[model samples]
Target chain A: MYPRAFDYLVPRTREEALEVLAERGSEVKVLAGGQSLIPMMKLRFASPTTLVDINRLPGLDAIDAVNGHVRIQALVRHNDIIRSDVVRAENHLMTSTAPWVADPLVRNRGTVCGSVAHHDPEGDWASVMLALGAEVVAESRDGGTRVIPIEDFLVDMFTTALEPTELLTEIRVPRYERGGGNYQKLERKVGDYATVGVATHLELDEAGVITKAGIALTSVYVRNLKVTEAEALLVGRAPSAELFGEAAAIAAAACDPTSDIRGSAEYKRNIVRVFTERSLAESASIAQGS
Target chain B: MEINVTVNGTPHTADVEPRMLLVDFIRSTIGLTGTHIGCDTTSCGVCTVLVDGTPMKTCTMFAVQADGRSLTTVEGLKRNGELHPIQAAFKEAHGLQCGFCTPAMMLVGSALIEENPDPSEEEVRWAISGNLCRCTGYMNIVKAIQLAAQNSTTGGTAE
Candidate 1:
């Protein structure tokens, strides 16, 4: 189905796109790769008066290493991030999660920032970004750019801390000291959304005791669920299969899995418990190897 | 808007609506019926085409956005009335039945072989998973990709 008639603006610069966004505010929608927005528009869920095409916007599709951490532009495509040498080397979790996003064709059009801004609870990037302690950079018409931690950025399901007049500029991931991470998602088919997804990061010391851990679960609630209790359980403890199982149980208990045709709430919870344990154990092994 | 793009090696300029999709522009404006539009959403890769070198879903892209870019549709695969290796392989392998999804399947398969000449059966399946064929001839399609990869001699011998 064709989307409703709208004025299209192909802005060559971020300044131009922001200017249009500032003036039009909620009446205007930013088009990154049109992966999410177009589908929504066609379905009449979103009927904007103007479309600000920012594909040509400068400095929005780059990946760089700065401040000892990897920085990615919000407009970077999924395939681009997956293929970036610096991102793959420095952030293996993000690298691993990128390929599982959708099929290759979807990755060619989906943008990292767009996904974050769209803020779908079932989206793979949100939980992975949350697990990595990623930060978001947003610019408003008031000439101020704010940095928001991923924790605070995701306010709830389908919502963010971003103002209507603000446009996301980039996402900043902090430099981790010594951590190996893994992302595992359970899907029914090739392009279907996750039924239960887990992203885990484990940092161990020479003694193989967990120094730090981050666990984020998605597609189980209104937003990406952070298993804080699970992280606390593993901290300062030896990364063991039994410990991982206990933490996974805690996380599974924390999730409020919704019922869908993909699976029942009970089934989703079961997978969450099992995958969480497996992912944590796998991440621990990789951490030890590293 | 008047947009300029090179389709199948020929540069053409057309006056069209800003909202016109790339697939519509190619089929309606350029009169190339080789590419089919099965699903407008990016889900079905029936409208797949090479933007620069990577395969993209034409239904999700606007004609205006493709201005000044090099586009290679399925129509460009043939030379001097000779079928591309991928098309020939599909014919030999009986990869297509209904033919609704053939153009897109061929485009994605050809592009996959070009990138990875010796793609495994799993890799080939993953590569064309975006393109759906209701006929359920996926096994033969996979075999056709294997044949094309072997013929390319770029190190892809389907396992």
Candidate 2:
């Protein structure tokens, strides 16, 4: 399957790429790792007339923990996250989820930020980002930089609030001194999309009380759903199986999954509840260790 | 667009359409047919090749993306006009039956053994997880990779 002929523009610099995006707007698609775009193009599911390959642009591939945020640049691939000591030291959710993004070959090319931008409901990054309260940094020629929260940035399945003339440049995950995050995914097999995925994050105050909480579900909703009610239920409470169970029940009840080959809606929702509880427990345990 | 790529130590300058996949370029343009395309979609890693020493699914990558980059196809496995340690190990362990996925498997295996001189079975399995062997179960393939890792005195290089 070959993609339709399109003008491939490899811009030399970030400014040049931004200029192209400003000129073409919706007509041009920003090509980062091309792991997702190329496949969609080949399937003819997406047929953008032009593609501005941003791979040649410099300084867009750093994973740095600075200013209380772990800044993951656009070009930082999944394997990069797996190999990054900074990520390992700063964010446990991303570290646990990086190796599970896809198979090794796909990881060698697929970027985490690109995955977040793509915003596929089955994609794992957004749920992790949502659970961590990460922010998306979109850059444009005229608007400068607009940092949109992940919840606002992700509009729907394969949809984002990013303007056509804007490019997603970075994802900033807040750094927590005594925090833990975990990604729980149930897939049919290795390299397959998740049947049900739950990302949970917890930040504890020195007094063993939950100061911040994030819980998001993947492949169980029309979009990656952040369970705000459940998160509200977790904050200010101590880490306990009973507390986590209540939050998990709320999350499962909150998500709307459809019946398909992966499983029945009931089964997926049940898995969501179970995985959410397990991930929260695991995360709480890890946080307690710190 | 014109792409300058070094494949198997030989540089080739060619004009290719932006939509032309790297697998098509290697197999059809450069006439190296060792890299098979089992499933055109990224699912099957049969079209796997080392793009600058990184195993990538050529079917998923554009030929134009290979511009000014080096690639290692299955044809380049022979270092000194002899079989690569991976190839010899595959033969020794009877790793293949139909031999459809051999080239991609060996390339992934060589890359794995290169990084880790001694790999556990789990690691070897994980490294080749992207590849699929339909002819036989992965036991022999895993064993073959582990054997190749041990036989190679200088890590992945047989010589």
Candidate 3:
């Protein structure tokens, strides 16, 4: 399949990109990794009038450790995040979850910020960002920026809260000390989108009591599902198999999955339950050592 | 639109439509058919190519996106009229049957061994996870990559 013909604009600077976006607004689509947008265009699911190519823009690809947070620029690809020692050191969940996003080839070009902006229900980065309480920074033509929390950024399937003239510039993920995290996914085959995926992050106090807990589910909801009630159950409580089971049950109950070729709703809920338990157990074991 | 790209060590300039995919540009415009487009849906890695030393699915990227970048396709795997080590290994190991997926397999294998000279069996599987081989069931392909890693003195010379 071929993409529909569209005017392509290469912006060497972020300022140029913002100008193009502001002028074109709803008619323009920002091309970052081109992993998701290209496919949609080829399938004719999306036909934008103009494509503002930001891949050439410099100074937007760094993964830096800033003030108690790891700031990832919009241009930083998935493979870059996987290879970044700073990211791995700060949030091990990202490293473990990135490989599950897509194959190595796709990861070489797919950007985390782009995936988060695309807002696919099965996007691993979206679930991970929710589990980590990440924040997204969007820039506009007027040089104004808004930092939107991950929860507020994702609105619905293949939709985000980003304005028409706004471009995602950076993603800030808070750094946590003595944390243990795991991402568990069940897919039909390698490189396939997740059938059910769970991302869990836990921080233990000096006494091995859960001080912070974040849990999110993917591929089982209209949007990335965060089990805040389950997370609250974990905090201030000691790690135990029974407690993890309860949290897993809560996550399974919270998810609203539709039956498709992958599995039935009940089957996916069961997978979510099992994966959540396994991920929580693994995270708890690591938290004890951390 | 015009694009200047370095493919197979040769810099070429071409006037291509902005919507032209990199795989189509390489095959139809540059006349390098080694990179096959098995599935244009980006799920299949038959069109895998190295862009600036990184393996990328060319079908998902536009020709304009590849402007000013260097790309290495399967046609570049031969050095001085001889098969590259990875290609020779595939030949010796009988890693291919119909030869449809051979080019992408060899290219991805070369890139994988280049990154890790001593990759485990699991690592080899993970490296070529994107590229699919419907004929060989991947047993012989895995062996071919392992043989290439052992016999290769230098990594990924197809540059």
Provide per-model DockQ scores: 0.64, 0.85, 0.87
Worst 10 residues of 3 chain A by lDDT: A87-96
Best-to-worst order by TM-score is: 2, 3, 1
Residues forming the 10-long window of minimal summed lDDT in candidate 1 chain A:
A172-181
For candidate 3, list the clashing residue pairs, or say none.
none
Residues B87-127 of candidate 1 have per-residue lDDT tens digits of 88888888899998998888898889888989999999989
In order of DockQ, best first, we have 3, 2, 1
Ranking by lDDT: 2, 3, 1
- Residue B129, model 1: lDDT of 86
Task: Tell me the docking grade of candidate 3.
Answer: high
Evaluated against the true structure, the overall lDDT of model 2 is: 0.92
lDDT of 1 at A97: 90
User: How large is the C-alpha RMSD of every model relative to the true structure?
Assistant: 2.3, 1.4, 2.0
| TM-score (C-alpha) between model 3 and the true structure | 0.97
TM-scores of chain A, one for each prediction: 0.96, 0.99, 0.98
- Candidate 1 ranges beyond 4 A from true positions: B154-159
True contacts kept of 1: 0.52
Give the alpha carbon lDDT tens digit for every residue of A1-290 in model 3.
98789999999888999999999999999999989999999999999989999988999999999898999999999889888998877787887898877898999999999999999998888999999899999999875999999999999988898998999999999888788898999888778999999999999888888999999999999999999999999999999999999999999999999999999999999999999999999998887876
- Per-residue CA lDDT of candidate 2, range A1-290, in tens? 99999999999988999999999999888888888889999999999999888888899999998998999999999999999999999999999998788789999988998899999999999999999999999999999999999999999999999999999999999999898988998988678899999999999999989999999999999899999999999999999999999999999899999999999999999999999999999999999998
**TM-scores of the candidates in the order shown:** 0.95, 0.98, 0.97
